[model samples]
Target: MKKKKQEEKEGEEEGRKSMILLSERQMKEIYERAATIGAKEALKFFEAERKKEYKGRADKRLGNTKLLLRNYHMLKDHAEKSVFGRTQMEESALDILESMMSMYDNEVIIESIKRSATRTAVIVSHIETMLGLYEAYCDKSRSREIERRRYEALWDMYIAASTMSPKEIADKQHVSKDTVYADLRIAIEKITALIFGVDGLTVR
Candidate 1:
């Protein structure tokens, strides 16, 4: 009877292993498909938005840095919504986004300074500041991209680790943690495809 029980335990373990493999494969497939669809839709939205260009003037009388910072905050709010889609990101991602927004804010301020300042030294300082901000922005953008990829990877790992339990994985990631866990469900389905074979992962 002990031998029989041992055999039964082994069988259950093997079954679990098989299920894990199958779940991983299925999750990967689903991730790719959803990512592809999301990418295409995001691209379409970006292209449409880009085509609408409007001209604006910077007021020299106003503190350009403050105004630009305000605008940056507004845009950042919109960007966070667009990127995370109601999901809270890790502190790292938020830091990178904030830095990028600050760079943009500084860039606008420097441009205003260049136009308004009469002293040659001040103009040069503004120019230097703008250049520095631009470089910083580029670096931050790259880092943000890396962080985003990491987030996706970690999420997938969590899903696999949790045995495809949507609620469990969400809880681990500190994402939704409530409701029906729709975001996590969609993310797992789409991210699997994205990591495996989907193309055009560019942000829209």
Candidate 2:
């Protein structure tokens, strides 16, 4: 009986490995297909929205950055409902999966979903799990531009202060130490505004 149980466990593990390999392969192919469809339509919409939003402010750098971020969200929503497929989970299950992002990063959530996919029989498994994984992957890749902004200000400050004392940073930037400190403060504020929007900090 002990030998039989061990053999059963080994068979299950091998089966899981096979399933994982096959599912991962399929996901890559489907992702490429989704990307092809997403690129053309997303670009067209983004361009139109950019021109519309920046009609008279072509030189407004911060305004342009905000508009691009907003347009990206629109693009992502369109893609989610279109090429990337839909969630098959219950509303509660879906909410739990999304909430997982707070505790686990995208890469962790995606791999967990992929591994989870191996448990169900091929014909009976829920496609929602795999779709969620793919959507997470797609969002991560598509948001690369927005993610870049998350570090923009910090990077600038780092560049200014990397090899210099705070005093030197002020001298190099043509400002007093107080102003250098202010510059660093403003850099953080800019990153926060870009990420979270300016409305919260705005005074009516």
Candidate 3:
């Protein structure tokens, strides 16, 4: 057993010496090949992870935006009434409300609501601004005719304060229900980008 162990040790040392004797160019070639293969596999892994993460984020974003739009007037009203002395700038009102809340007891539920309301206020403001921008974008040319209709569809469906159903909006816009649904999707995507910036973009 001792002799076998000694032989194994000798073999390891010989293998190490042989490895050390490899020419620099040969080592470089081996390293390059390993790196190339490893990098490809690593890239594939990361890309898959990125795509999965993107899908999760996109779903959350779209769902939240749709919920907000469906309850736009309620959220706007809640922010206004909940925040005392509401200003023209709803976001500023929410900011003041948050500051005031921080002065009181550290109630977890109230603090959570304050934070949610603040975020909702900011998102509401972004939605309003996005609509204004879309209006201007539509005025640029007749080429934006479809975009104009899509914009109106979104407005009537959500921001008009008297929200309409998809079928109602389709009838009002003289389009198919499928077209109305498609428009709402595009509008929500635009709002997602407006609210979340580059991170809101879909992976595909």
For this target, which candidate reaches the highest TM-score against the unseen true structure?
3
Kindly state the number of residue pairs that clash in model 2.
0
32-98: candidate 1 lDDT, tens digit per residue: 9999999999999887765432111111112222233234323333333332322333233223322
Report the lDDT tens digits of candidate 2 across residue range 1-204.
Answer: 999999999999999898777577789999999998899889999988876654423223333223323233332333344222235332332343333334434445333333332221121122223333433443476665433332332344432223345576566556577766655444444532333234212221
Off by over 4 Å in 2: 1-156, 159-164, 199-204
Q: What lDDT score belongs to each candidate, Candidate 1 first? A: 0.40, 0.43, 0.69
Q: TM-score for every candidate vs. truth?
A: 0.18, 0.23, 0.64
TM-score between model 1 and native: 0.18
The parts of candidate 1 lying over 4 Å away from their true place are: 1-22, 54-204
Tens digit of lDDT per residue, candidate 3, span 124-183? 565677678767876685868788888888899888867789999988989999999998
lDDT of 1 at 99: 33
Provide the lowest-lDDT 10-residue window in model 2. Answer: 117-126
